[model samples]
Target: MATCTVALTAIDSSSRQSLEYSSANQSPESDDEAPRMSLLRKLAVIIQLSGVNFASSAVNGLVVVGLPTITADLKLDPSLAFWPTSVSSLANASTILLAGSVADSIGPRPVNIAGGVVTGAFILAAGACKTGPQLIVMRALQGIGYAMHLVSSVAIVTHTLPRGRPRNFAFSCLGLSQPLGFSFGLVLGGILQDLIGWRAAWYIYGGLTLALSVVAAWALPNFQNEGTFKGTMRNLKVRVDWVGALLASIFMTLLSYLFAIRDPKSIVFICLIAMSLPLFVGWVHRQVKLGKPALIPNALWKDTAFSSICGTVALSFGVTTCMELFASLFFQEVQHLSPLQTGLRIMPSLLVGVALNVTTGLFVHRVPALWIVTVSSIICSVAPLLMAVIKVQSPYWANAFIAQVLAPMSTDVLFTVGLIIISDNFPDNTQALAGAVFNTASQLGQALTLGIMQIVSTLVTKDYSDKILPMARLEGLRASFWTMFGFMMLCTLWGAIGLRNTGRVGLKRD
Candidate 1:
């Protein structure tokens, strides 16, 4: 895995060269008066970035929304069926650094385009798979493509755009991608799966992504020898920790595996902790001592701002992912809503998240990021705690809907603040790695939450029959909320202390 520190060093050196070259040749007045990009061009960039986000997030949403359907259709064990999603996430988390390195060697544009194409191809192939093994294989490939697209897209935004209005607006544009795509995917995936089947849904998603890949290849700018894109591919010296990557992948796989085994609560807990815990600890130690190019750099551990923001992002994602996963189960099993109905109900939260992201983009340069993050964290903590108080007979408006709304509003605000905080702290060159760090943390957080929730939900249901009623299942879900609420509190306190109050203009890179 590529560390943010190494990436930062590369970005800083290139930016310094650009500044020096500009000072030597251009008059200060002329440099200041260089023509600003038009509204149309800016919009074009935003659209492209959003498109990139759309493709990646939509795929994730599809996997999440369609997982149960796939399991039923294939008659596979839920744990076995889950590998398609879990392995894909692992592939994505593990491959980001290699993708970042590729972005540094080549321009971000081609890398983004290539990723889009590969994602399209693999998703289509996944749809065609007839067996679980084939589907898992295809999903793993799709994960690799997702890692490439995300890393390249962020790098392109960081390198190609100027640092003020354009960058902020681009951040807003990129931010719109996940929530909106997820919202749209859930609704559409449900509808499509109902009417045309899940396989057809995958086909449609693949085709749409293919179209975006083509447009991106044509419309996006290429950076070759440019300041942010500066690199000598022929002499690239950074090494990758293949062994560490392998161990990390295995550790994550085994951890998820332990969770999937439906065993006695105490036995499952003991087994997972005894086996996977030590494996992970060993992986971390190996990365620290034996890694040549460490998967994640140790230097980043010392950077307060970077570590805090990464933790914030991880917690935010953990809360959001767990909520979405459990809530869908609640609606289907407890509330008696069909998947289609559940998707429709969830649409508002997704839309609200998009609106908040765009709004955050506009206000990031004006408001203190610390304030936004803190407020969002407070909202997250309060919402779930409120939801936990509701009785089985409580109205949706009084408890469920209010909790749902807060989730998106809180997540959007918190995620945007953390993104800006991390982006500002890392140098432009390392911006891609910074994104990888943030995203990896985000995915890992989600995975951990899922594992934890699986345990909680299973244990709570043991007193009941295997065919647990929805309302009864919800009672178990309330236990998980306590965990999420604790995460929010920790993040809130961390943001309050760690996020710096840079001047309310352009943010300063640490």
Candidate 2:
């Protein structure tokens, strides 16, 4: 696999070079401008971009911490309660590719502002939802907005910062926002649940998003596709692959819907999953035929570095998310901790992540990203394995705390490094696409894997009702950890074998 990936990398490099040579004669609109802002101004822009990431992460974290309260308050069937998170992830996974394509064509600034507005509105509306179905609809809309925010935020960062130290630093700060926001959400969600009620979490999230929208409008630059086409409707229509985007969205939506449905035995669900396979194949074929305007250009598959990193990142994200969800349940149900206590207990991991985020940013360009991934993979694998051994009577400091700390160390490092690798390999034209693919994989990984794991947990724990013995339900949670352990082991092997030890931007390659 490593050898095959290396060969593909070579092919992709040569092909990209050839393509660039052929396009050399084209007229230029404007290449990326060199950064001219003072350090304070640059930091302010970074804060704005990172704030978008922070808002998204905060929402996700709130879901994780507040799900139990939501389930109880909304009178949701325990089995169906996962829908709020799963549905949002499904919507995000389905739309992100199209969002990235749109960002590339129209520029990131508009997407950022528009996405923030939509996300804020939907989240605020979600606070008023009276039924599970209403919440699902609002969450799905919020997901679309999040997809826009995610892809465009990364594009803006990559576009604004040149390769090397500044870009690395910016990327690291963006990465840091995820954990920072997540930690804040966990605490805030717990407080709201205890004080004002779970609905307050949504109100706070919505308010933050609205503020970020204003910041994005003021901070983001409106960089166009340099020399690609004039701002005419005909040219715009020709440049954007509407058909490809539609097909890709349909395929992902079908795929996500298949996983979201609880009934694996349902003929309709099975048929949808089966149908998506062909739709996906057709989308790939369409992209191949369409060339430049394709939602996902054919050239991306040939870029071995990008492809490998995407796969590894997806799997890692899936396992990590699954573990987090299960752990949250374990803390609340088996250990009988309050939501606030659970949030506080999870803090050590975020602290570790903060330190590593800084370390990764400062050293990523000096180190080979694959090495960081490989080491993190190994550590991540052990964390889940430890969780699998934990019992209802296990000590918090000895079992849960250690795993939390080790787990985030791996996830935070991998996430930061993964973004850096994606930004480094792709050119400016496809930066948004690359970001979209990266984030889509992360969201899909969470949605699909968590869906599967939820089903497994339900089945595994069904024999012992929570009414009979609360600790009995943990049997399934432990099983999920073991399953995550297996996935992490696979990620470790893939990182070691399939991934190349590529140095970050401007580093000397041996």
Candidate 3:
């Protein structure tokens, strides 16, 4: 049987070559090469890609508003309620690099379609889950699919659009989709939970995903490497470093576990978490030794601008996600707001984010990304600090509203500028990988920092009863906000000092 299998494989390879030769000899009209795509086609593709991103972001937004409802419905321990969100982020962080590599090795089209279908299936499955564990597992699967979709979608945009105004505009639209989708999901989830149940929110997400999967299959162009199938397969087989992949996965898993685990104060867990640093360092060294087929090439590390941008993204975005999670809890438990009310309250920030992203997308090409990131980071810190100082009876307009407006502006600017920097720095071949790394940093930042903040909050407000007074709970939340403020300020400093000025117009590639 083995002998026959090998023989069949060899025969298939030879047949593929024959087909390639025949196709190569075909007439010139058989392949009408267009140097540039029509503007309409470009817009259509960008819209579709952005739509997919919107779907993913909407799902994340649903989790934000739906989490309290889910916890109540499932009769979950409040401490464990965070698992649903953290699991998804953990899965995405761990698998993103591999997904990017696959997209690069094959093509973005297949990865995008497959990711959407898988995400839809798992999310639908999650809607019917009876236990917290089941829901967490399903969400993790959804995260894997989301990672594939995100990496490929970003790569497609970078690959399709040239590196100037069109690319910048496309990236801005892509960034804008996140806040828009998130806002839509927040409102939709709350409305659905009020009308039907929290489960309905998952159903909606699943249905949309399945529909988008079909649309993507039709709309996405096959920009696979131009070569015989056999040759492409051979290249993929030889270039994929399985050892590096395994090590990286192990490293990411340990790091994620270190952050996501609820009992951060446990001595054993702390030791285990501490061990991951050495493993990570070793993984980097191995990648350096492995050279070409490395999971993360050395060239990426050499790019100081890329490193600075990624660090800034992780810090700033991490704080943003943590703030949203905690703020949702505060609105529901402390202020005793309904899910719908919480969504409505947060709408202004999302709207501001969308508007800012649009404006940035239109004109960011004229400014240095470093300056945008630095100025935004400084302004963004004020929101959390303001939140930390707010009293229970503070006026909404004086405190929450102002903070909300400022928060989104920073997030939008930082995200758009970071994407622009990445898109400009990396070549077409590694665009997917670049997107994956950037997203991984964001996810890990969320997972790790949020975990730390939760621990800090717990420790500071240990005397407060979780089941009792709202004021007690507010104390811990305030502590977390202070921590968030500190981190944001540090990110501001990093941006100011570390990021290089890339000139006034377009990206300055190092």
Candidate 4:
């Protein structure tokens, strides 16, 4: 809390000239956040924010669970099937940095509601699509809206809630919504795919999103800023680092696109990817020289602890998402289970995620972050290995159910702790950007790991003469699991070394 005050106090008077009349940047734990609220009001706000995450994640589960049917029905090109699952992430990562700046310039409430509306609109549009390309485009648009909501929601929660256990619990609820929603989607998507069709599930989820949007419009806090629309836009033009944002977005977009492809070896592709790094670095340097608002300052990464957090964030997210998807595929494609059975098999992950999230939020203030993350990551690393070595004839109780229970432990823990540490490091006014940086790491991990694991799985599958056989595909999936285990181990090592000095985060300073 003192840290927040110090940062806010450092902003010089001259810099305040362009400040908008918005409540974009408020101190976490400020008494101004209302020292207390009624229980019912708190519930409405948490539900509205957390529900957004649930709806988005549920739809993602639908896509992953129903991929086979969707591909077959839409006559999607085999090469393009991966796009629907991943394109939204690419777009989300690309725009989130900018969205963070926008959220800060304006208020979070409008941004939150607008994002919900756009996300719902696109989800509905996606359901009505008749072609793979159409679905891919619509999902891409959803990413943009989701980015708006996610970044703004972080700002909202940080400013609206009293910091400490209350704030911690609220974030935990937000974290819980994602995996729980995804699991619901898995079961619901499975049931819908079997009983009716995947499209109906999308329709239902999309409608739920719009309803949530209405709630957000009414329930979210409306912070007052100083300037009119014209003044705000003018300030955005001058204060926001568009060049820095563009450079970062371009690099991420290019790299993510390359990852989505099966064979991406063109010299042009390689050169552009290579060039994007140095160019982005140079641009950041330029931003520093000009004393401008950089999207993400280069110096921020110099802190070994912060850098390590970002690295571990990527690996943890990558491994967890990989496990969820591949486990689903292994159940259906390798074990020859029906979609409903596959969804049921993955239910343990959802249950564990819910418990881990709430538990972490409750006790995080009492323990050192280093111990929490490193130990849990070590536990999680074992999950992929369990799946890798399991026999086809093994019962669910033997290793499969245990793996599902363990897969999500570290990720849910890291998300809560990481967000706290990362948010603390940033200026009080840049809370949305803090959220953006954290999420960008998660999205990047998912994009790169999923692509790399996909390639590894494909190559290993092709190593056998009869690659199409379930037995051979099982070997390939096992190879991917092995790859995930390796990454999870890396996450554990990095977290242990990086967060060694990170004492308990989210402690009350009031």
Query: Whose lDDT is greatest here?
Result: 4
Clashing pairs in 4: 21-225, 21-226, 21-227, 22-225
**Residues forming the 10-long window of minimal summed lDDT in candidate 4:** 11-20
TM-score for predicted model 1 compared with the true structure: 0.81
Could you give the candidate ranking by TM-score, starting with the highest? 4, 2, 3, 1
Q: Stretches of candidate 4 above 4 Å error?
A: 1-30, 35-39
Model 1 agreement with the true structure over 156-274: per-residue lDDT tens digits: 66665445544565666677788888877788888998888888778877898888887786666645422332244331444344555555555555554555566566475566556
Please say which candidate is ahead in lDDT: 3 or 4: 4
- Cα RMSD, each candidate: 7.0, 6.9, 9.6, 6.0
Model 4, residue 45: C-alpha shift (Å)? 1.7
By TM-score, the better pick of 3 and 4 is: 4
Give one digit per residue, the lDDT tens place, for model 4 in 295-348.
878898888778898999899988998898888888888788888898999999
TM-score of each: 0.81, 0.88, 0.87, 0.92
**Candidate 2 local Cα displacement, residue 377, angstroms:** 0.7
Clashes of 3: 0
Give the range where candidate 1 is weakest over 10 consecutive residues by summed lDDT.
Answer: 25-34
lDDT of each model, Cα atoms only?
A: 0.67, 0.74, 0.74, 0.83
The number of clashing residue pairs in each candidate reads 5, 1, 0, 4
Q: Which candidate would rank higher by lDDT, 1 or 2?
A: 2
lDDT of 2 by residue, 397-427 (tens): 8888888888876667777677876765666
